[model samples]
Target: MDFFDKAGVMAIGSRLRMLSEQLTEEATKIYDLYDVGLKPKWFPVFYLLSHDESKSITQIATEIGHSHPSVSKIVKEMIKEGILSEHKDKIDGRKNNIRLTPKGKEIAIQIEDQYLDVRNAVEEILNQSTYNMWNALQEFEFLLEQKPLLKRVKALKKNREAQHVQIIPYAPKYKTHFKELNEAWITQHFKMEDTDHKSLDHPEDYILDKGGEILVALYNETPVGVCALIKMDHPEYDFELAKMAVAPEAKGKGIGWILGQATLEKAKSLGAKTVYLESNTVLKPAIHLYHKLGFEKVVGYPTPYERCNIQMAKTL
Candidate 1:
């Protein structure tokens, strides 16, 4: 019924295991025909031992990507077959080094030519398939090295949770929250100037009265962050993303991201074609968040605040 095929990506592990078993069985038959006593599972450890004779079990396990217990089992089997021997390191009494025996070395020499032939045969078999299996496998391994699948999966889960934050339009009841959030951030890092005071004192007069919009992010109905899209009197359709702040307690929960996205969305809905932001490089996390939100460093923008030395903008 080809359950593995029906399961598709969900059955990848099981399908790979089946594939490995089939290949190992075929290789075992080939080894029997050639009178080679080596098993497919032992090849990795044996190959490493042949090249570097005194590697510790930990070293072999790390190089082969096998667990310590798995490598220990293979080592025990090889020791029983007289293919390997173990000894304590001369300087480090706690370290045990595995070495290939004289018989193992002799067998390696005998199979040297057959190893190349078998490799060529495998390559030919892979080439007969529709896809380039070797290149695909190499790319897959490289991607895993770059970012492990577990890390990627965890990040996806975190992002999903972050998306749970709700962005709500500013209301009179949340007015104090908007002011306090921005005031806390600004006073902590940089002193508030007259322009900041004007906006914080009366957001409705300075922001909304001038065709601007403010969006607040709430986690469990508690306001955690706020951002304002102030309509700019410029030649291009422009809006400044200002007065953005996430509470200290909610800093790492991606509330800043939620507020930034909501602000941009509000800007776009207002027929804005460009979005600009002013900040200081010292606010590294804020600067990083801006960049992630598609903001790019730009020059020749006037700033009303003394602390703003960095200007970034995005074409909506």
Candidate 2:
């Protein structure tokens, strides 16, 4: 057919808008034929008020899924047309309740037969189609409710950016990123402890020299995440997964997960039987990630950081 028709789902919004306008025009003709003075755009608000009692603008907007300003404008227009009236709420004097006027009630009674006829007509159209349009619309709406288009598009964008992320070995040049990333998150949530300063300030001296391994995740050749596998002396665990941080601006692009999976694989390759980690319950996402990576809660083993309230271990 045309360009928009050829584009199919890519032109869904424009196509749907056009379809809605077409239906509105046809509905207007039907309303005129029945001698009913109702606008298609006003049908949602009008039909709602006709069936229900007085409701505030906010209530109407919420129930009809229309914006507050939209409902307010429609109510004003209907009030001017002598189809609706507003009065102060009895329960809440600060609020106003809107209800159908006498003329609106009479019009509603007059439109009852037209509504039945239109419903049957729409059902006939739907049944004539190969796929029922009404059912498809409802299912598509439910899918959109589950994951809105905004969130879906954002996730796709993040995944595309994450494809540029590369995990590299910690080098002298990445020292600043390693320290800064850890310090930024630590200071934002809790006071930087002496242990934090010791490990972060001298990762090479305190961690690398003691058989620990540090991995840096680079996005577009810039260090954005760092995680260390610190060799532990504990009886139950071999290495402690510590000092993991992603740059604030680089978060939610799957950098942390990339570094995490790489670090775990490296740990497993180093003859490690189990990996340990300490975290607080407040960091829900981090805790969830740790669980997803096969870590389980543990009660024993003390932590040097005061902020750490939970301990976990993963068996390789």
Candidate 3:
């Protein structure tokens, strides 16, 4: 009776192994549908070949975690079947460089599409909270790739019910809630050393004097989000949209998207031909929601911001 191999632990391990094998079989069937290799064993070879025209047998073996002799055998078979071609490496004449032919490249593209389909299939099966895990994982992965100091960690998305979101126009009475919402947003998501309230305030003043309107989203009668639509005097850009924010407490409820839609409808009702917004990219959820709502990417400000900011425009 080994303590390290207790019955309960062993049973759990065995179950996981069986599940892994089942996933592998299912994956093979998917690949077979695309006329590619039934299993992903060939995927590494395809991926390496697609990235570069040629790779040595040793390089392919190292990448795929296989023995050099085993890779040589596979490469030889592929060459015979016209799936791959071998060339003499110029730097080292002794080594053979492996490359995919046109047919092989076509299969590689199909394999890539199949991978995306699998992802979409899984997302469809999960609840919205679980589905948002994909977005969180993508953001964490992107950060890891860009920065050397960060270690990849699982960051599950915070969840809230969409029905819980409350929408309202900006009111002088709720100025305190509006201020707190903006503070909560910048604090929770982005690290702002100092905020220039003057910039936001100046625009709000000008818009309020003219035809600009604001909306604040509330949850439990507490303000959790804000947005505004300003009627522009300039004919070129008729409406300057501003002051979009979602508080940390009310995040992931899809409130921001609701606010965006509200703003768009407000703009349309006011006869605005176009609407525009300025935002930084660190707010990934906001950016994604904006795109999904039919906003297209456009060059706005001349200077590049540290937060990967971009401007979005849409025609009402």
Each model's lDDT comes to: 0.89, 0.92, 0.71
- Each candidate structure's TM-score, on Cα atoms with residue i matched to residue i, is 0.59, 0.79, 0.46
Q: Work out candidate 2's RMSD over C-alphas.
A: 3.6
How big is the positional error of residue 110 in model 2, measured in Å on the Cα after superposition? 2.5
Candidate 2: residue pairs that collide: none
- In candidate 1, how many Å is residue 113 off? 19
C-alpha RMSD in Å of predicted model 3 compared with the true structure: 14.7
| Predicted candidate 1 versus true structure: per-residue lDDT over 1-316, tens digit per residue | 3897689887877887888999899889988877888998998999889888679999999999999999999999999999999999999999999998999998889888778989899889888989988898899899999999888877786687686689988898889998999999898988989999999899999999999998888887788889998889988538999999888988767778778887898888888899988999999999999999999999886788899899999998
lDDT of 2 by residue, 92-182 (tens): 8999999999999999999999999999999899889999988898999999999998899888988899889999989999899999999
lDDT of 3: 0.71
* Each model's total of backbone clashes: 0, 0, 1
**Of 1 and 2, the candidate ranking higher by TM-score:** 2
RMSD of 1: 7.1
- Model 2 spans > 4 angstroms off: 1-8, 52-63, 85-99, 187-193, 279-288, 291-300, 306-311
Which candidate wins on TM-score?
2
By TM-score: ranked, best first: 2, 1, 3
